[model samples]
Target chain A: MDAGVIPISNTQLALSVILVLITGVISAALRLELLKPLLWGTVRTYLQLTLIGYALTYIFNINNLILIIVIISLMCLVASRTAVRGSPRAGRYSMLLGFFSLWTSTFLVGTIVMVLIISPEPWYSARIAIPIFGMILGNSMNGIALSLERLFSEVKSKISEIEALLSFGASPWESVRDCVKEALRAGMTPTINSLMVVGLVSLPGMMTGQILAGADPQQASRPLPVVVMLMIAAAVAIGCLMLVLLYYKKLFTKEDAIAHYV
Target chain B: MPEFFKFDQIEYHMGAAGRTVKVSSDLEEGSILVIKGPSGAGKTTLLRILARLLECDKGQVFLQGQNWLSFTPQLWRSKINYLAQKPAVFNGTVLDNLKKPFALKIKKDMFNLDEAIDGLRELSLNENLIHQDARTLSGGETARITLLRPILFKPNILLLDEPFASLDDNSARSVMEFLKRWLENETGRGIVMVTHNDIYKDISGIKIQELELSEPGVN
Candidate 1:
């Protein structure tokens, strides 16, 4: 047993199954019908995390820069795909725009944190780089999805207002400027709200995990502020990139008119 | 001699049912063209297409013999204004809503409070309404204010969709009369509208265009 740390064996992990058994029993008693989803979710989470854990362990040992880049690229690609699927009306350019924005913003912030701030030995160390990049991309993906969804929906619902601005000789950008602002603001709300209540209401996972693993409370809290700031920057960057790449013209016809469905 | 405004075979499709609409029309200087139709006939859609808000699957719109698309959207809209059926009242005073058009690049004139008051009077709205919050205004007042605000721009063409849909008979008459006079005084100006009311039926010198959507062997 490592000092100040407790590692769970397979037998100990099996004991944790009792919690799930109790939940399933409650679900059955209530006839909640949530048991299937609960079991499925638990099983899926275990499998996914275990697979990723193995992959990370391999990458960390290999310590090859190219492998790290490939893994990061894969993460960005998957996140972009999720964002594009979430925002259906973002049109044909959604995938490309989503990919570009996620990759650009994540790498920009990830590089800054890895090279400048953390300055880990062998700068691209998988331990620090992977987790940092994952957090940035994960949070930024949610913001991008939310903003893109809001932008398209707002434009669809408020087509008349937008067109009114256009008919008054306002350009396309001028017409939907308010919508863009609103979407960006909406995207930022989650991160901003989380930041507001970070330590008071709930301990963030990273900070809690560091504390549990015998890191000094002060040292663990030191990176919290920086991590939160990086998340916000990444979110804003991805949101703005999506906004810039979106074509307001596509929402209209050749005659410069609004479309029924965006 | 090119017509002031010309559209040929303007078409649009709606929903999964693929219900389609096709329309063609022309307007000369000082002309009033009324678009009339039943629900789902795409009357508003046609006006939207003409206004460049909605795209026509297949069609051509010409402004003074040049393709409408040739002009930038802002330039085209400067010449042709589209008023929605339900006007959106921004979060501000009535005066703010009225003055919003001036914020556009094409509007070079300064805001004239007196002119705006006079315009409001023509719609039977009180001069004091200018200071009132637009979001708090009644539906009829909102419609009147929306219609009047764009007149300040003095566009060559005005495409209105059900402008009178929210107004009382008296207010509708006042607006109709004001529009008639404005058309007469403003030379080469035109109006195209989709309406469900008979307020304009007796108004002399106005042409009506109806769209038929559902009946077999009819259009």
Candidate 2:
């Protein structure tokens, strides 16, 4: 085996398809009815990743600041849409709120990482900024989604208790304080748990990728994961906080009463 | 003089059919306004609207000559409290539930432990019940606790929705008596309650006015 990253040829990539074929065979044998989705998902994975791979290559060569920002903004928009899509109760207000939260938090953390920490030449280099922002955006998207979903569901389930507090003249913030706390906890729990068990439980994807791409294990294992983890933690916290703060207002009417839809 | 504790042209949609109910009424100082209606008549809705917990399609509420919009909802609610039919028993001890209101920034009054204990006594509840987990309280106990919670906050008007629904004859009678005394004890206080129970008729020495709500579009 070569020391540096060995490029996989089309023949080798075709050979990898056998693994999916084997999984498809098992699905057929068990009558699990998953073969259709399995094959479809494999195709989508290949197409999407190949497209992104080519796009990233072009993006890296261009490295224009405006282009990088536009791509990152587009990524944030798509991520925000996906984040709030699963939560039906989140309403239309959440889409805008989710987008703003994701954009703000990801950029805030991404700027810190790209400028002060990684300090890649040009600082906004597409190769560094796009991938780093992508990672932060992905994690923060999941966190915001989970927290927003939890916040809305908890508010729905605890409407009576919330109204009981409101009846005593508690402000909207006071009434939903407990629910907000629960939501923030829910949002951050996965990130915190990952922080606790990273490396021990599972090797993070970026570290493994770097190591495979010929970086030394020691170098791959240190600053990359540390900065990535810290960036994710910060982005997730800021995203979840912004989401709840903005979204909680939508749960009440102008009169401070629980909104009828809620 | 401006009418005390009045709501006019209060309208809200009820049920999936969107039947609209419009209500107009007032409560005199130190009196009881018994809201009488069959089920689904928007009795609970009326109380909620008055409490500003639910918005009315069209209405204006006035307290002590001031419009509802003049005050913040928090201040409006603190002055005119609404107790739900199914009481909200929070986690922790009954005392914690009692003290919960005072923790609000809007509340200026301190939680009076002595008054709370006396309130429990007046409602025929055990003083020791204060230390028990509020979530473990029986339906009747929960109802009384919720009622006591708003009273301790000292709202000028109490909007009650079937407050005696969970209580038995004895508990119901005692609660009614306590409410009667509560009204007479304060010069400016009043109650606008929704109750199908006839127990309020038995209480003497306080003026009780009745507002009967008919089904929407029927009358």
Whole-model lDDT values for every prediction? 0.78, 0.90
Interface RMSD of each: 1.8, 0.7
- Model 2: how far residue B170 lies from native, Å: 1.7
- Once fitted onto the true fold, the runs of candidate 2 whose alpha carbons sit more than 4 angstroms away are A1-3, A9-37, B217-219
Candidate 1 stretches with Cα past 4 Å from truth are A18-34, A223-256, B9-22, B37-39, B108-110, B201-219
User: What C-alpha lDDT, on a 0 to 100 scale, does residue B75 get in candidate 2?
Assistant: 89
> A68-155, model 2: which lDDT tens digit per residue?
9999999999999989997877577889999999999999989989999999889998988987998999999999999998998899
Is model 1 an incorrect, acceptable, medium or high docking prediction?
medium
- Candidate 2 structure quality by residue, lDDT tens digits, B1-219: 888888888888998989999788888998999998888888998888888888889989999889999998898899999998886778899999999999999875599999999999999889999999998888888889989999999999999998888899889999998998898887889999999899977777868999999977542
Candidate of highest DockQ: 2
Q: Which pairs of residues collide in model 1?
A: A256-B52, A257-B52, A257-B53, A258-B53, A258-B54
